[model samples]
Target chain A: MNMHKYEKWWMLFGSGTLLIFLIVVGVSAFYMGSTPPYCATTLDPENVREHDSFQELGLKQLDDNEYSLTILASAFDYDVGNPEKVIEIPKGASVSIYATTTDVIHGFEIAGTNANMMLEPGYVSTNRYTFKNAGEYTLLCNEYCGVGHHLMAATIKVVE
Target chain B: MSKVEQREQTTDPHEDVDLKGTLFGVAIVGFFILFSWFGVWALFLSR
Candidate 1:
């Protein structure tokens, strides 16, 4: 049978479908790279302190103010796997995080929060986020470093 | 009676194998499939 009669229909459908797919991929790529909302807080894994040294770390204050946080991952703690600690910040503030590995390779990823900043083993990966609401946010190690990778995690608290 | 022989014939090889047209058709179909996949994923599934 001659394919002339059906050629127009085929071309129309084919071209239309192609156009739609191109549009979808373009839009999806745009949305995928977007950062989630979170308050601005700077974190330095190299200088982070425990809850006891809140003032020494310059993180002691409920003044609804914005402050930067510095964290340091030692070789033992970095190697030992355990629950990730959390940091507290105020809502509607911006946060900047810088993380790097000290000993072996480790992963850092925030849980229940829009912070998708990735932490590299030796290299520092920086990411900024703004907190729109007040709540508890946990930091999770996305990549497995070694036997203790499972215990590599932390949290960040957001208050009013 | 004398013995007789019969021969079978086939259509033109070129006519049966449309290399250029087939390639074009495949390319068009592929583009369409990819286009639809992205469109649906972003417009509906992403939401």
Candidate 2:
């Protein structure tokens, strides 16, 4: 088909840019492991308090320099083993955090860190992070659940 | 044919459009896309 020279160049430029974007996304998601959160595990929200993991929530050392932190999000509260308690872990330790919400949807975000996940009722969300330095990181709920949303926060203390 | 009719017949619609301006706009958009994508890679994905 007969086409203008400018039209041809524009078509080529558009398609090339689109191809580059797709390639970058594919590489980042597959090769570099920059993927969206996945939660196939489900449980009864009502029984979360009784569940073994939630019953004994908070940090547990699994191995040398490795730990697991289980958290339960409820109405305007984040229960890290005990409510209003600061979760403490050793610096330079790898922590795998598992969280679920019992009341409404909440956000699990460790301020000034890459640990962020959305906690929904009945579904378990998880994130793995390593704290390399000793500091106190604030854990805040980014999702608006109720009037006390502003008060829904906790502290993560990475001790040396 | 008259002079006016002859002039009209010779004019091309595509020639009237500014190709350089269009190309410049496309380049600007492409630049923003690349900048944003690389920013995400450097900040979020590179770790």
Candidate 3:
């Protein structure tokens, strides 16, 4: 009988790598589902800041009745997109969003929070998000047009 | 047929294999699957 060379090595290496990846993914999925996704934006004062918990999207209590945020995207580079900068609307009122790219097409999406919107070059897309309960939401650039696409990310804070 | 020709026909030399193509195809497929899975997870899950 002829023995197979490197068969065991290939099998073990492939299966091991796949198993590790799946395990990491399984853990992350559970954690993400447990915690409400936080919304982040590029218009942050500091580079990064953390919010205690989820609040309403837009409210006057945070000291502003309305807010306007402008972001720039050129070719493949993009300015930051901060969800906290997105005004938190009052309990019953709506928070308006006006977003556009400077050069290329990009999508602005808030995952799991009904904040799905898009942004295009030279044109602003405006939408409103209303929140009754307080929770953190995640904001992400849902478009892939460049090398730094993965690095384009931020969060939105909704505080009561 | 000559005796030498009959002996050469009966003996085996080696198996021909397209290792480079097999490796390249496997690498491309594996990378695509791995990155796509990671990209989706990072995009959707990393909140």
Candidate 4:
């Protein structure tokens, strides 16, 4: 076959680029444990209010600089347990957010942050994020549950 | 010119075409894809 030199080089370049992309994603998925959002942990939605963690939906210190924030997404509100719809934490603190819905599926997304999950009625979705900067981040529900979905939001205040 | 002389003087059209411009354009596109991919990848890893 008579192939031009430029065509041969172009094929190499294109194939090489694709190979690198596949290797990167493959390594991250298989070894580093980076994966897409999914539903694995589950519980009884009917009795969620009585569950150990669900009993108190708020932030709890787990370690020196680590914390766990339990949240319940109802019809159109997120109960972070606190009267104020805000989660205040020190900068650089690692917070594991466990979110679950009481009625329908809702999107748990923290604006400007990578903390996003899908909260299902009987399934528990969780995400961990360390707030490195001091700012007030918005927590909006990306999923439309009902007429009040637009009003569903929370606040994540990271203080330095 | 004679028919045989004219036929021999004709050159291959493809041989005269310069691929440098196409190469440069493709190189730009490839780098753009790579840089944007890294930007997203870095964001995902950093957060």
Top-DockQ candidate index = 2
TM-score of chain B of 4: 0.66
Best by TM-score: 2
Arrange candidates, best TM-score first.
2, 4, 1, 3
When 2 and 3 are scored with lDDT, the better candidate is 2
lDDT of 4 by residue, A1-160 (tens): 4455676777888999899999999999999877666667889998889888788788889999999999999989999888789988899998888889889989999888888888889988877778988999988999889999999999989999
TM-score of each: 0.47, 0.82, 0.39, 0.79
- Name the runs in model 2 displaced over 4 angstroms: B1-16
Error of 3 at A47 (Å): 24
Q: Each candidate's iRMS in angstroms?
A: 7.0, 2.7, 4.8, 2.2
What local lDDT does model 2 show for residue A153?
A: 90
Per-residue lDDT tens digits for candidate 4, residues B1-47, read: 66765355454565567887887888889889988998999988877
Give candidate 3's root-mean-square deviation (CA, Å).
Answer: 13.4
TM-score-better candidate, 1 vs 2: 2
Candidate number that wins on lDDT, 2 or 4: 4
Model 1 lDDT tens row, A1-160 = 3344335556676787767666756764686554433324344434444223222331334335554454444443431122345577788776555455545545555565545554444445555556777887766666666776676656677789
Ranked by DockQ, the better of candidates 3 and 4 is 4
Model 2 CAPRI rating: acceptable
Q: B1-47, model 2: which lDDT tens digit per residue?
A: 66765344555677677788878887788788878977876766433
| Candidate 1: residue A84 lDDT (0-100) | 40
Which runs in model 1 stand beyond 4 Å of their true positions? Answer: A1-67, A74-84, B1-47
